[model samples]
Target: MEKRWLPLYGNNLEAHSTIENRSLTDLLNDTTAKYSDNTAITFYGKTWTYKELQKFSEALAASLNGDQFKKGDRLAIMLPNCPHYLFSLFGTFRAGGVVVQVNPMYVARELEYILNDSEATHIVILSDLYPLFKSVRDKVPTKKAIVVALKPGAEIELEANDCLFESYLKQATAPAPAITIEAENDLAVLQYTGGTTGVSKGVMLTHLNLVSNTEQTYDFMFSGEVSPPPNARIVNVLPLFHIFSLTCCNFVTIRHGGNQILIPRFDMPEVLETIKKEKPFQLGGVPTMYVGFNQVGKYKEFGLDLVESYVSGGSSLPVEALEAFERGTDRKLCEGYGLSEAAPVTHFNPSFQERKAGSVGIPLPNTDAKVVVETDAGWEEVAVGEVGEMIIKGPQVMKGYWRKPEETERTLRDGWLFTGDLAKMDEQGYFYIVDRKKDMILASGYNVYPREIEEVLYQHEGVQEVIVLGIPDPYRGETVKAYITPKPNSTLTSQEIIEFSRKQLAAYKVPKAIEFREELPKSAVGKLLKRKLRDEELAKVEAEQSS
Candidate 1:
């Protein structure tokens, strides 16, 4: 079969390629050795050189090894996008321990599930989040809690097994202990999902999986453009715990020996100020951040033209948001698609080529993707422009779900990782995500993808945010329903929204019911939580019927 994306490859990209087999720590070591004095990371007003980052990570790694943390031991990291997060991430890898990424915004219950599931022995967290951990510490198997102060001179009341992050690093001045790591087989990081579909499971990404994905992203982003190694400064506003941010911002920058400006969280003012002051050449963000930046109406004043490349991931970029962002900032916002199972990136819009609006561009080099329809026999590849599950085969694919062989077998079969995302490919090989397989609505025996309706709804002037879901209908098996958050102070009614959607979508796909909302629930990284809206609507219906 001919790959349609070959002609769309960047000038420097090949139709197929191979990546080096190396551990994440090896990439850090190589960069630190080559760019010792170069700035590696910038947070707020402070900076850490490659040498400094390497030294600090090594120090922490020594401490972990000294504390009898062996290879394959899970070390949970629950800090935000701080310098401490990097230290802990690399330190765990250097100590031959698997790093389990924990969302800093998780409550005690969510935190307990991840810790207990991964069986993490140690955790590095921020002082502000100490209470959440404290509430669930006894329920998990965590042996030590290393706390980092978010503010300077902030004191933390440590428990018996707790230690300050700085103190832990200070205990090991010697070089990191040597440990052999099998890059292909050894687990490097266990990334947890948001559990939108079901219970969150650990995504076990091996060292090779992460390293390959980083290289794949680097090749696509830097191909035929400005090289890295002190020339590129990538502004990272996404949370470090998310795989999209982890691969693109943290590892990709480290791979190129480029500087990363880290923001603790997405504060529009802080992000704009940092971009204006720092003058970063590249920025990675989600669609919501792009929408927020477009709404700021201050890009021209701040001279945001310095940003040459803007990459969007985590969720499908609404066409309205993309156009507004490009028109507002005079920069192209390339939309990409990835999931936690594929080391987070399988497809990205080529930076140097014609970026198709509403498409997630082509698969990365050496990655093969095909849309397949499930058949009684097994699975059959679908034709172009036909919707099906997007299955990908690449080195970046995860080994499997952590410790869940049955689930792993179900997801990974025949060397293809079955992405639960429903997508369609055009003749040019660009893929447009239709929706999640589980999120597809069956109404009147016709399939309706919520994303199609949501995209049309987003184009409405009064619609600020909208989530389309399926509700149980008495006539049709399911009916389309839209929950819309209107623009502030805009008296947008359900009739206006339904009328607007009717013009763009098919009669069957048009929302049967439109409900106005003040705000929509979003994930920590700002992706709209359609599952929450679905659950709430279902519960309300059940209550109404019962009453």
Candidate 2:
């Protein structure tokens, strides 16, 4: 099969097509050496230069090296988008330890499962989240917990064995000890994600995987443009634990010697103020963030015009949201596509080229992508414009899922990572995601994509947010059902919504049932939780049957 995306590469972008054999530590070291005095990160009000970031991370690494931490040990970081999170991340890597990214919003049960599964020996978490760890401390294998205080001089009472983050960093005022790293083989980070199957699994990303991804993303973003334009600034509001932010915000900023304005969480007022004050060149977020900005009414007053690039990921960007955002900001929101398996990025809408409205764009340089139909014998490549499972072969792909050989084998086959996303490639090689394979609804032998239905619902003036799923039906195998939240002051009824959808969608694809709700469930990163909704609907059906 011919690679249609190859000929579409932007000028000078082909140079980065091949994966560079480098480690993330090396990339950081090189960036710090080149941009020593340049501001690397800004949190709240304080800023850390590239030199300072490296020095502090090295110091912390030295301290961890002297402690129970060692090479190959998994060190879990459960902090938010603060300096402590960055310190813990690079420090763990510098100390030859595998950094396990833990979501700060996880409850005790979720934390315990991840900690026990990863077998992490140490954890760096916020002071306020200490109780969540304490509740599950006895059940997990974590040996030490270091608490990072949110404010300066904030006193936190710790258990006998625990230590303060500042006190721990003070252990070494000198440089970190020398360590050898196998970039390609040695795991650098264990990022947990619920892949298509909705089961949380640790994706083992090596130093090379992250390094390659950082380079690929940097190249894809700035192709044909000057590298590290003086004083580049990227707004960082997405959670650092998310792979999208980890690769794009943290690593990509460092790779280009850019300034990162970190926000702990998404507060619309604070985000607007930060944008106005910092005047960042790049803004990265999911679809929901853009929707929020579009609805803020005063978003233009916040100086969004300063943003040169708008990158969206973590889920498909709705066309309605994209159009609204572009209209509001007069800037195109480039929607990329990735999964947790590919170090989280494989394709992005090239900044230097024409961006298709509903497409995830062509594959990144050096990345080979194909849509394949699963056959009885094996996987077969589908024809152009045919919908199938999208698989990618790239250096950015993870080594495998940690301690899950069977699952890893099922996911990664013959050097290709089988992304369980249903997508179609156009004649020009632009990829448009149809929907999740699991989320596709089967009604009367017709394949109905929930996104198609959701897109139509989003066009409704009264619809604020919507999620479409399949519900079990006696007549049909599965019936399309839509859960919707009406806009404020809207008198939207189920019948009206059904009628509107009927006008846009086919009878089988039209939502058979409509359930109005005040709000729908979303993840920490604001991704619609269709799985949760589907599970709720299934439970209801089971309950009704049992009763």
Candidate 3:
């Protein structure tokens, strides 16, 4: 309820009482008009100027409309990071259609649910992934599909209902249809959260929500700079379908009229070489990417000093990685926090001010947060430094979960969003996430947070990566178990990890079980999949009990 971070907010940064309540295309159009000749995108060795990118988007939009895809319709876009992603996104907005972001990694079963649930009538998919969609095509309601092969001539079977992406664009060189947009009410993107805890639901993000978030992210990142320097280049390797990459990388690059250098995937050597060649002023990615940067240990050699700002989101950046990055590059890797429900960014460490290593920093401009715990009576705001669920209220917050009124009601209370994340705020307003509310382990009636144990385990030399979770225990109700990936060439054992953890953690807090693996499960953006590992362990326990 109080603005504890206000006193610390500086660098000429002031909150905007009202951001532009306009469609995302308004942002795209203004940038295109202002910087028509600017190089908008660079994919491999090819580049697209603003004029060319806009013309392509217009052509795609006209063709989609000509093909009977009308306003208010949903068009799924499933592609990796490339120029095609930008075209599909802006084209959907101009065509008055809602964009449904589908992960390129999704299989038939996972893909079918989103296609059916969102009632998407069309999809723009990758040629490589076309057969996967074809496998489940008859089961879904999609009428048309546009398959894109970045490198043409890769054989892909196409029915009469499907067309090649270039062919689809060439069919209509007509101007974009003039479609009126109700920015506040009209849907922009149906961003689906990873179905870790349960079924993934489509988050209804209106044009106003996304545009507002883009503005907020820009202001927070640049410290209220009017515009980035001329010809600024942004090197992005994060997946395009991810909201974090969409807003922070794609949207921000548009706002700045900067050059976006794209990499198809996270090939560490390529990323480093691109940074050196392109001389981008900023770099952003998940914790794992930062870890890879540290592992490669080529910050100075790769000319990382050219990049002045480094951002980490999608998941928490391990403190160890953060420290290692600073030691390697002599620069801070600022970590922030957000969720799909809030256009994915609400707080980031202040770029020009004191940054706490573990905290997710304070709320962004025009946003507010409180750490509140639910009591037997009702929800109550927790005292400073006390652990509780974090609640947020901001213009970036999603309108609601699509078609799921009950879920929408449960997650959005009054004007605040119940994030379902356990956290605490210091007196200075910096927030430290304890863990997910559902991830607390009860060992001998004592609450054990997996993140707390995981952080301690990270200090061990042999442990490369670790995930901790609660397992059913006969006497303790639930015991803590850890799944770990040991460093290459390390002679680490389960007993050694247990003995190491015992020294740093209380006896009850120590992991009762340890399982070693070559690697841990990760999401599309490389966030560790704790729930997936927990589910597998639970399934094994169920089988043991039955036997």
Candidate 4:
């Protein structure tokens, strides 16, 4: 059979080869050399030119030495989307140590787990979280030093507590010794994600992996019209700790010399205010974000009326939400797909084309994707139009899970990374994600994806948020159940939600039972914790049966 190429994916492959020749530092320096006088970052109304960002990063790199930190040591950063966060992270990378990104919203429990698991010797945290650190410091045995950043608009309360973030920067000495790092050999970052079995493991990304992925992302995004729009502004509210923002919003923005207006956290009014002020060209978010943003009462006030592009990822983008956003912004929400292991970008929609709503566009330039179909005998390759595990091989795949060789071996076979995501391809070469393997629900001897049912629920005007999961059932082994959070000021009942879902979903896909909650439990990064909800429902059933 002849090889197939996806539309718009070829142009990026050509550009990526050119980028492969340079090291990450070489790329950073090149961008600074050309756009040094241009603004590279804007946060809290302050702008940093490419030159200033480079100089600050160099100075921060200079402050670390034998007494403070050493080359190849792990340095974790826990902060929001602030200028200091970016400066500290890239500086750590420039200093030759690995950057371990931790979510700023992490509680003591989450912080302790990540700190202990990564065995990070040093950390930079925001001052507002100092008390949480004080609580968990004893639990994190490997952490040797801590630097705090003054939380914007918040008072520093950790002065009496051992180390003040400001005081340490004041005692800065000469630049640290220059260290050599192989673009291919050195570990650049450890971004953590949850597992199907419960434990969370760190996904180890390398410099070459990130650089190559960024280049591919840029090429695909700009492949359509020969020239990208000038002085593009992007609204970045996604946490920088996430792979999506780290590549598309932060690193990619710096590479392109784009102006970024950062929103520390997602607030409808605040986001609207920023949109009104900046009138950005791009909006990057997950499925839930668009759902919330599209429902704002003052949608016309944001001036997104003329926004050019909106990219959705991190979760499945519902066709309903996409349509709603288009009606509000008069623009389509381009959907992409990736995982933390793949430098977080394996596929994205072409910027200048008519997109299929449910598809995740095509494999990025230089990225190869194949369907690994599991059969009764063993796994085998499936042709187009078949659904199975989406195996991808590209420059973006991570080095491996940090310190978990067996798990790494299970995930990365030969050169392809088996993502455990179920998907199928069309004759035209567009890929449509069905659902995750672990998320597939077996009901009445049939397979069902919760996303299909949840999407139906989202179509209901009254349903603000919904999570569909498999609950224990003696008759069927497992049955579909939905937990929903209604829209504000609305009185939506479980029966009503189930009735609404029944109108759209097949009988087997419809929830056998429904539960209502003020809010659903989510990860620090806002991804739904379906496992938690499933466990809660199972516990309730077990207790009821016992009674």
* Shift in Å, residue 506, candidate 3: 37
Worst 10 residues of 4 by lDDT: 1-10
Off by over 4 Å in 2: 10-12, 15-18, 173-175, 195-198, 225-228, 439-547
Clashing residue pairs in candidate 3 (N, C-alpha, C atoms within 3 angstroms):
none
Per-residue lDDT for 1-547 in model 1, tens only? 4789988774679876568888999999998888888888888778999999988888999998888899999999998898888989999999999999987766565688899999999999899988878988889999899998978888779998689998998776566779898999999999975222335689999999999999888888778664553536888878888898999888998987888888887787888888888788888887667767767778777767768878888766668778877888878788888888999899988877888998999999889999999899889988889999999999999999887888889899999998888899999898998877667665643446676567768888998988888887643557898988888889888788777766555466778898887888999999999789878877988999899
Per-residue alpha-carbon lDDT of model 2 for 1-547, expressed as tens digits?
7888876784557834556677777888999889899998898789999898888788789988878678999999998899888888888889999999887766665688889999999999999989878888989999799899897777677885789988898877556778899999999999886533435689999999998888788888887443446869888988888888999888999988899999998888899998998888888987667777877856569988667789988766668778878887887779898877898888888767788999999888668899999899889999998999999998999999999999999998999998888999988889998866666565543446677677778999999999988887643457788999999999999899888876665466678889999989999999989889888877998999899
Tell me the tens digit of each residue's lDDT in model 4 across 1-547: 1235454454434524445644456566778888888777778788888788787777667765634677778888888887777777777877888888887766565688889998887778777776777787788854544455554456565533345545554446687676787888788889987555435689988888888888888877766653335556888998888889989887777678777778788777788888898888788887767777766745677787767777887766667778878887777678998988999888877766658888898778778888778789877878888888998998889899999999899999998899989998877677888767767665533446677677778888988888888876643446798888989998887678777766555466678888888899999999988879877877898899799
Worst 10 residues of 2 by lDDT: 438-447
lDDT of each: 0.84, 0.83, 0.84, 0.75
Error of 2 at 98 (Å): 0.6
Q: Which rank order by lDDT, best down to worst?
A: 3, 1, 2, 4
Output the lDDT of residue 170, model 1: 76
Worst 10 residues of 3 by lDDT: 440-449
**Could you tell me which residue pairs clash in candidate 2?**
none
lDDT of 1: 0.84
User: Which pairs of residues collide in model 1?
Assistant: none
TM-score of each: 0.81, 0.81, 0.81, 0.78
TM-score of 3: 0.81
